[model samples]
Target: DQIFSSALTAALMVGLAALLCGAVLYPVVVHLSADNEQKAREVLDSHISMMEALGRAIAKRDSDTGAHNYRVAWIAAGIAEKMGIEGNTMQALIAGSFLHDVGKIGIPDAILLKPGKLDDTEMAIMRTHVDQGKDIVIGAGWLDGAQDVVAGHHEKWNGSGYPARLQGEAIALSARIFAVADVFDALCSKRPYKEPMSFEASMAILEKDTGSHFDPGVMAVFKPMARAIYDQLADCDEEATRKLLQDRVKHHFEQ
Candidate 1:
């Protein structure tokens, strides 16, 4: 009888010790998890800020207000979400969209800001921006993932684009997805050289290009959302557009 009582006390003592340990460790574990999450968020924000700063620098060099980068990124994110792209690929798409034209920083102002059509020589120099952009991103460890769109955004579905001329699925999917967003934003946004094309007219042009200049599947996904995206972002000021894009970036990167 005494042995059984001692065994019961020992078992109760062990259980009580376990409960004490858990009671002490639970808050510590929660604190560590929360700390790690905050650290991760800070890292993501820093990366995003770096991307935005680089994008703005390129935009300023090209005589833009930086709305162009924000708009394209936002538009690309929308299309990617609709197409069921998420996680890292989605993050890369957003980064690439913002920094796609970053190579333009290397172009001569004479060619980059040309008021008229680029002569063949000037055009060739302009085309080199893709390579310049590729080099820039490849050298930056944080931005290496953006290389796909940076290098291939100019590539066409047909084998006609410059720098690489990657055709069809040979073009990275992120690049293909961004191609539509870039051109659509350019068409719908006014430039010093031309008026903004109407949404209907822009869609008409995109439809005309179809499989030749864009991925058919990507185009199809973008078609339905084009109107709403255009309406929301086409005329937004820099502040409004940046805020909208920030929300998207946060959603993608934080998740």
Candidate 2:
């Protein structure tokens, strides 16, 4: 009986030792996991920063001040939220807005930088940017989400637009949302070919193109917020606008 009791006590001591060790190691393992996660995020953030920088570079190449892309991103995100677009899909819209013109990087300077209107041949070459842009985004593992927008941003609602001529809902919703924001910013911002239109004029143009150029449903949601979005972003510079939109991407996409 004495020996059995001693053995039992020893077994209990061994079990307690194991339990104590596990208890001590649990928090350490958790901390290590957290550190690993943080490191992974840092790596991802670095990739995103590089990708965004590339977007800005592409914008500059296209003779833009680079603020246009950021503003478009801001507008697209807001419109998307209003339209109840959320999750990874919404991230695609925002990212695609930034990188939409990335394919312009491939276009020759003569055509892409021409201050005047593109002639028929030049227009054909320019339109190839959408497909090029899709290839660029789709090839990048991290940016694969942006494929829809990059490929279809120029597509018209009535199937009159380029590349695939995708119509209505057949076009990815992200691209549809982006089209509205893209034209809105384009109309409001000064370009080499045209002067910036006034808010009222811009709204008029947007309203006129509702079904032909943009998704009617998306436009319906955007019409009410257009002026407000412009007011909030009109005064911001490229860097300021980029930072604001970057924060949105980090919050919505990176999280």
Candidate 3:
């Protein structure tokens, strides 16, 4: 009886220990998972914040539309996805659409802010921004995905564009998408040199240039979203727009 009692007690102790471990382990595991999720959320927020700061910086660089960059990036990514470009292509769309005109950082204030039309000499200087943009993207460590867009975005579907003057398939796919995004933003955005053209007029312009200025497949995608995208652009405040242009231009030349 004594021997049997001792054996039963040992068995009871072992079972109780196992139950304690199971109970304690679960809360620890749950706590760790919750901490990990919080950390991930913070990291995601940081990346978005950085991108917004970059958008503001780029606005300072060219004195053009800064938020317009963000809006176009969103629109172009949506259109690119619909057209069957996936994965890294979508990422490139985001990066390229945001930094497509980064080379304008190198342009002189004269051409960038001229109140009138660019003469031939000014236009030539203006075009140099394409090559300058290519160099900037290549040199910058953070903008690895943006170089192709900066360099090739100006290239035409019909081989009439600057820099490499690449035509059709020779141009990077992101650039092709950017051609539509950039033109749409430019036509719709109020600029120092030109008033914002009405949407009806802009559509007429885009339609006329179709195969010559933009990729056919990309245009097919942009057509349906054009109205919606303009609405997004319209949400921007003009005072903020003017301040961004004025401040950014002043800062760039000061540097």
By lDDT, who's the top model here? 1
lDDT of 1 by residue, 138-181 (tens): 86866888999999989999979877878989999999999899
**What TM-score fits each model?**
0.93, 0.89, 0.72
- Across 76-184, the per-residue lDDT of candidate 3 in tens digits comes to 6767767877655565567667767777777888888787889999999999978876776674444566777878878999999987889998998888888887788
Q: In model 1, what is the error at residue 82, expressed in angstroms?
A: 0.6
Q: What is the C-alpha lDDT profile of model 2 across 38-88, one tens digit per residue? A: 999898788778777887679768758478888898899999988788888
Q: How accurate is candidate 2 locally (lDDT)?
A: 0.87
Which candidate has the top score in TM-score?
A: 1
Superposition TM-score, candidate 1 onto the true structure:
0.93
Give the C-alpha miss distance for residue 70 in model 3, angstroms: 2.4
Where model 3 places Cα greater than 4 Å from the true spot, the runs are 1-47, 139-142, 238-255
Candidate 1: which pairs clash? none
Candidate 2 at residue 89, lDDT? 87
Q: What's the distance in Å from true for residue 126, model 1?
A: 1.2
Cα displacement (angstroms), candidate 2, residue 130, comes to: 0.9
Ranking by lDDT: 1, 2, 3
TM-score of 2: 0.89
Worst 10 residues of 3 by lDDT: 246-255
Residue 7 of model 3 has an lDDT of 95
